[model samples]
Each structure stands twice: as C-alpha cells, then as structure tokens.
Target: MSAPEGPTFRELAVQALSSVQHGYDLLAPKFDHTGYRTPASVLDSVTGALRGLGPFGSGLDVCCGTGAGMGVLRQVCRERITGVDFSAGMLAEGRARTPVAPDAPRTDWVRADVRALPFGPVFDLAVSFGAFGHFLPRELPGLFAQVHSVLRPGGTFAFPIGAPARPGSRHYWELLAFDTAMRVRNALWRPRFVMYYRTFRLAEVREELLRAGFEVELRALEELGRRADGSPRCRLVVATRPV
Candidate 1:
C-alpha cells in the first residue's frame, strides 16, 4: 500500500495543542509523509560515518519516533536493536512498518521517556534524530546522562547536527516565527507543546555532553558539503563513555 498523505494545517494545529505524546500519536501515521522524518540522505551519511566504529553488539534509538533511526542501527548492530519512545501510537505505527527477517538483528520496542530510560549498560550504540528540539535546554544534561548510562563503556551516542540557519535566509525567518509562536503558545496554554527550532545550539550541546561525562568528538559528514565560511554544513557528534 502507498504511504498515507501528510497532515493538513488543521491536523497540525490539533497536534500542536495536544500533549506531546498525544500529538505524536495523532501524527504517527502521516509522519513519514511529512518532511519531518529524518531525511534519507542524513540517515545514509550517519550510517556511513558510523560504519568503522561498529559491528556494534546492541543498539538503541532514543525517542525513536516511528523507527527511522532503527533501520540505521539494524545495519550496524550485530545482536540486538531496539526503539524506544514515549508514544504508544508512534510505537504501534513503527511496529507495523518494521519488517522482520531471518538473521536480522532482534528488534524490540519500549515506551519510555528519554529522560528516564529503563535499561542498564547493555547497548554499544545509541542515536536520536530530529527529536532533540522537543527537549528543553535545561533537560539536556539529564537526557544525555540517561543515554550515557544505558551505553556500555566505550559505547557511542551519535546524532547529526546541522549548521545554524543563516540569519538572512527564509529558513531563518521560518524558524524564528515558529519559535515565537511556540513562546506565545506556551504563555497562553496549560500544557505547552515544547518544540523549538532554535534552542539546540551546537556549542551548548557540546558543553552539556561534557557535563554529563561524555567525551565528545565531531566529524563532518563531508558528503553533505561545507558552508560559505568553510564550516561544515552538517556534522555528526559522536559522544563516547569512558572505558
């Protein structure tokens, strides 16, 4: 069957007003149809960069959403792969789409918040995509610590970070407008939908990772190319727990 169509503006409005889990549950079926799912190119670039670092025994996709990141983990991890998210609706949709294959890494789905992951140091790698914007800046340290705690010694927690939106671009204004609307929404609403496009700065993220005891390194996904100032257009942050 063909994938479902994307959500309309009213549908998106309803989603924005609901709590995050409920919003995602309502959005799950049409998520991939929207441009919101991690782009395939980003996924491939991340996979390519992580190839030599793994043969990873087990992997986790934190806030796994509809399981796009799990496909990347399935390629690299040898033993097990799991996707965890707080929304049952999203997990159900993911389970339906995910194919099971012989010799495929074992796959499991758990419904849990990333801030309070319920696992030991069992995974050799963990990843998240596009979900960081949901987390407030204050929550990042705890979130990073949770991911770090679930990873074995020397295990890597990796994710892609794009260069900040250029100040004069349409993309910049779009993000600025989105953030302003979110601020206004939060001020007027009881349960704020906590999505912001601008809060997850690379420098702030790097500092939080360090404070959470991760040793972080960044490698440009050069296939994505560089910006006008010679800075990379995109980079993958590989944060490792000490062995």
Candidate 2:
C-alpha cells in the first residue's frame, strides 16, 4: 500500500516526471523493495505452466526489469537466456543479482525496446512480467509482433494475466485511482508515461496475439487457486508461432 521504504513522495514525483527509462533507472536500486515488482508467486506459477512445454533451448525475457522473469527462464532453458530492457539502470541491477550456475544456461543483458526487438528468430521461448502496463493498447500489435519475430517457428511467448478486479472490491477503486492519476499526470507532463493498469484486458490481448500470427492458448494456473465464480485467479497466455 505504501511506497517503497526509500524514496519519499516528492522524490517519486520527480522520478515520475522524467521519461519512463529515466524514472526506472532512478528507481532501480529500490525497485525490488516496492510492491511494483512482480511477486514470486506469479513467477513460480508461470515457471510451472511453462515446464511441460519446455526443455527449451533458449529464452528471452522481454522488458525484463531487474530480471525476475529471467530467473524462471534459467530453470527451463538449457542453453542461453537473455534479458532485455530499455532501462540501463534496471538491467545493471539485474546483471548484478542474477545468479550464475556452472554449466548452466548463459545469460545476456540487452538494451532494446519491445516494439522493436533487435534479435532474429533465435529464441525458443520468450516471457515478460509486469511490464505490459507500460505499453498503450495501440502498441500491443507491434509489441507482440516483435516478440513473435524473434522466436523460431513453434517457439512460444508466455506471460501471466490476472483476473480483473471485482466491482466493489478495494482493489478496483485502487486501480481506478491509480489510472486516473496517471491520466492526469500525462496530461500535465511532457514525454508521458504509458502505464495504465486496466488497458491490458484478456480478450483484447488474445485478439492482438492472434493478429500478430500467434496461435494462442490460455492455461489457468490452478496453484494460484480460483475466484468465487470458479474462474482461475490468473492464467498464463501461451502464444506459439506456427512452425
């Protein structure tokens, strides 16, 4: 609920006023301490969901912030793993914290935009976490296309999507408030930040993935339990490029 331990409101305001890359760079040192970092539970669930599909040769963590998703890739990818982020600050922290294993898959940190990936069809698997909110809905097609381009035929791109907030729940209002604030900030600021909590809906996401030439499937992460309606609390959207 509270902002990360360090960085007061004024400091965060200053950071937010900057470009997204610069803001994250400034926040990198304390980024993991904040609740903004994807939780371990979500990461674990994604890892489990990808296990049966894998024994994959290479993996990429797109928009990898501080490399949490890279940790998951390390387990499933046998040969090499790459973490790419436009934020050098975040990538630096990721490079430092990521553990190295003897004879394990090699890891590389690259700086690139997801909408315009720099790699060819080289990766067997690609995953992203907690980074989609940074992209506008209009950007989804190109973003997914770029990821699709970098994967070999039959390769997969995976990421988790949580259920929408219930109408009357506190989380609903909290998200609404955050989005409203972001809109206000963008209106008043230059080089606006693109994070909008509600923009990435499941249906629209699936449509975009399909348009990008991926055959998409949703696998409910049962380990996260279910909502009152019996629907999964979260699902891993696995989109595979046709071979």
- Weakest ten-residue segment in model 1 by summed lDDT: 1-10
Candidate 2 residue spans exceeding 4 A from truth: 2-6
Distance from true location, Cα of 239 in model 1, Å: 0.2
The local distance difference test score of each candidate is 0.93, 0.92
Residue pairs with backbone overlap in model 2: none
Q: Tens digit of lDDT per residue, candidate 1, span 1-243? A: 113578888898899998888999999988888888998999999999989788799999999999999999999999999999999999999999988799899999999988999999999999999999999999998999999999999999999999999999999999999899999999999688999989999999999999999999999999899998999999999999999
How many steric clashes does model 1 contain?
A: 0
Q: Candidate 1 has which clashing residue pairs, if any? A: none
What is the C-alpha local distance difference test score of candidate 1?
0.93
lDDT per residue, candidate 2, 1-243, as tens digits? 335476677767878899899999998987887778888999998898899898899999999999999999999999999999999999999999988679779999999887889999999999999999999999899999999999999999999999999988999999999999999999998889778899999999999999999999999999999998999999999999999
